[model samples]
Target: MTLAPRLDRQPRSALLTVVMSIGLIYALLPLVWLIISSTKTQESLIGSFGLWFSGPFALFDNIAQVLSYDDGIYARWFLNTFIYVVAGAGGATFLATLAGYGAAKYAFPGKRLVFAIVLGAIAVPGTALAVPTFLMFSELGLTNTMWAIIVPSLISPFGFYLIWVYAAESVPTELLEAARVDGSGELRTFFTISLRLLAPGVVTVALFAIVATWNNYFLPLIMLNDPDLFPLTIGLQQWNLQAVGVGSQPIFNLVITGSLLAIIPIVIAFLLLQRYWQSGLSAGSVKQ
Candidate 1:
């Protein structure tokens, strides 16, 4: 008889490893360049190789300039970004959790129609709605205001869908019924029992919403004309643009430093919440 193939044998394992290694390097190149570029002084930044440090280290100097330039407007932008993420992302997470739980557990009139609408909305890119949203906000006199940015960000279709799927699978119907039979009111049962079970899913959705709101650029660009109301994304972009026009003052160092600062909070959030995200992904993997 012909020899049987070994159970541990894998064809193309080396090829797969090589491909993944290349992808990892490709993904990291820009971030590495940004870090190296941020450490260089303005003159050195323009003259030196992008991926390596050159001359004296100016990372601390660049950070100080980024925070203090234009009468400390960057601090205001940082505060504004914090507000947007707290209000917009926090509200989105809360609302999506409620809606997703209700949709998964309750039978209501027009439920299917509502799901259909949400699915359609998810399929439509946010850019496609930006013009209409701007026009509507303009009519309502909300443009150039923080409300313009925060309001639209409060709706997250993808977060809703993720929670819906997670909740449906992770929460047991019998447990809910048992709580109801024990004379617990719906809200009480949900708060005491269901919410605990849904922690991973909720945290997963919250992270998604937070990241989306934090990185939001296009809607804020169209909605807010006031630099005072700018988030870090818009504020950094303004600094980048200053280098373009006539009589331009290129503050590339500030822009690079500010970008690095903006990335820190998001990275920390992911690091802190990754356990919940991973648990949510693997929730139903094993059968009891």
Candidate 2:
């Protein structure tokens, strides 16, 4: 007979709780500041304490300005960002899911080489590759185009690695063999069987990819010169930059309010996908 170990629940640590509370405050401080600052007028922003509301609440007024200012370029930027996230992040997740599952399941030539290359790529920051990528795209006459952003975003080594590990552990080889014995084609089996098991991993990778692509600044800044093609990150920076050089017109309040509005979608995405993300993270906690 096998004996199970006794499980004892310990009291929660006060020190740990305090540390977490401090970390929570640290993380939320900037967002709180952004929210509060967004409600202030231009002069109130410069005049008042950062954490408190000052003067009249101009959040609605500022939002109106953000949506209407400069012929509503912010709206266009938001649309561009949405397109990039859908194409770039969505493609990255799909390709990563396919590649990772293949790598985890199949034995192919140069598999180790591919793994090594992915690990090396993950170690290298995107900024390091930005210049080389720009030069390559420029040679292909693809610079200043949306493809410049979307194409690079598609190659997510980290996402691929994540799915590879997840698929190997979470997906059962016996189940795959059973499907094959039942005469299911590889494509059909993967789509019908493997994909459902990979759902949590897929959602986690998608969220990461979406956030990365949505918040991408350096890539778009170098790849696109056209203001109309700018995502929210670059567009917001442009608005902030208006304070510099000759004929300076600082719309600091609009910048603050725009920033507040910009983060809403990402927060919404997290809230919507939180369940899947949590499951993905906790999936490996217990041995099956």
Candidate 3:
């Protein structure tokens, strides 16, 4: 009887292990292919096997060419990405945290209405707002400017919701009351006590904002006509356009290399900040 039960459980465990392994491969396969493909020359990229090494690695050369191409415009795109991610993500995180903390902790008139509006905003797709955003930026004479991108990225409804839920549950009401009793004003208490407690949630929202803004293409594409002001996403699209002709332009190499470079910042940011994400989730679950 003991042997029979053990055998049945073993099959279930074995099946689960296989399923998890398959899922892992499915998730990582494309990334592996990209890494391999980025290391190959144009001839090797076409002639080589899809998943295996078939030529001398040109990783360094490809990177050099990508960085040096078109008077080092790729570097400019990189700088633009840094500006967008830092300003967009950092600003959005701060605003969202304040809004969320206010909604959750304070008892004020029209609070419910404000919360409803935020939820409605979250339900609305970003793409739906792009046209209006373009028109507004155009009217303000901000088209083709960095502000056009940064301004829109600063308002993230989902980010607000994340921090609101986090602040409500992670921050203890008694702590705020005790701080007030100690002669700390609301602003001081928020800056000193609540903000530190909410750091993990803030970091989580910032990461989401960074990724969203970094990958934003349609808005930048529509808002900015200047190729010099393009982010990596739009720049890559331009390379793809150049690659379409059957002549000796040979922009396929640049397109592939640019695509690979575009992914680096997001990957690095995630790897560095993922610990905060873990800490945030755990903090949210802890008993207040």
Candidate 4:
């Protein structure tokens, strides 16, 4: 008989492994339930056991209904989410990269104050700024518009900070001096040289910003009043509200299925981008 690895020599390591395995199961249990629940019909979902398959398989049916419901509003929400993530996260990443690289490399006045302010912003809760932002945007007539979502998401203190710390160490001054000596402009040097080296940090920041924008609820809830402009977070919430109302057509199945589908893109994005992130990190680790 094959023997298990000896744990007597490292009890703490074995204990930690056991604890982490339990934690992993705990984290994954809800997702497993969601998958099983989503495959069941609305009636079965209500009557059947939550952790196991209870009703007739309605996964495809549920997906079809989710796609077709209310003139396909889910499609619109998906598009809106795509736009918000792309524009908001992309803009934030670009700006963060520029600011971070500049801060790390350049000598300037008030740089410390700028860094301090960014650090302070990181400490402040996002919700604390929501009401004031709403008031300001309301005055500017930007509320209930895509700009409301996109504009605020453009600022990522953590992204900037991450890149700043990373660039200060990962990027070398010698390379930049060489570029300058070769008569390359700042923009050219950044695009051709610095950006490639900063890929991992940039991708990390972009992913963070993308997730924040994708899963954003509170800001969208307060800023937007129109259903047409709602992202998946708000749109799904509206469906949940309708489902819970007295004598309402229970769309619980559709909601669950839609939610499962909604997460696919994000999962795919992470999977697709992870190799690049890893390669960048690996490259960054090498000595110049």
The residue pairs found clashing in candidate 2 are none
Better of 2 and 3 by TM-score: 2
Give stretches of model 4 more than 4 Å off: 1-12, 275-288
Arrange candidates by lDDT, descending: 2, 1, 4, 3
Candidate ranking (TM-score, best to worst) = 2, 1, 4, 3
**Could you give candidate 3's per-residue lDDT for residues 85-166 as a string of tens digits?**
8898789988999989988899999988888998999999999999999998889999999999999999989989888889
TM-scores for the candidates: 0.94, 0.95, 0.91, 0.92
Error of 2 at 44 (Å): 1.5
TM-score (C-alpha) between model 1 and the true structure: 0.94
lDDT of each: 0.91, 0.95, 0.86, 0.90
Candidate 1 residue spans exceeding 4 A from truth: 1-12, 284-288
Over 1-288, each residue of candidate 1 has an lDDT whose tens digit, in order, gives: 899889998677888899999999999998999999989888898768998878999899999998899999999999999999999999999999998998998899998898898899899999999999999999999999989988998899988887787888888999999988999998998889999999999999999889988999999999988999999999999988886656768688899999999999999999999999999878777877
Top TM-score: which candidate number?
2
lDDT of 2 at 175: 97
lDDT string for model 4 (134-184, tens) is 999999999999999999999999989988987887788999999999999
Model 2 lDDT per residue over 1-288, tens place = 998856785678999999999999999999999999999988898769999988998999999999999999999999999999999999999999999999999999999999999999899999999999999999999999999999999999999998998999999999999999999999999999999999999999999999999999999999999999999999999888885546857688899999999999999999999999999877777887
| Model 1, CA-based lDDT | 0.91
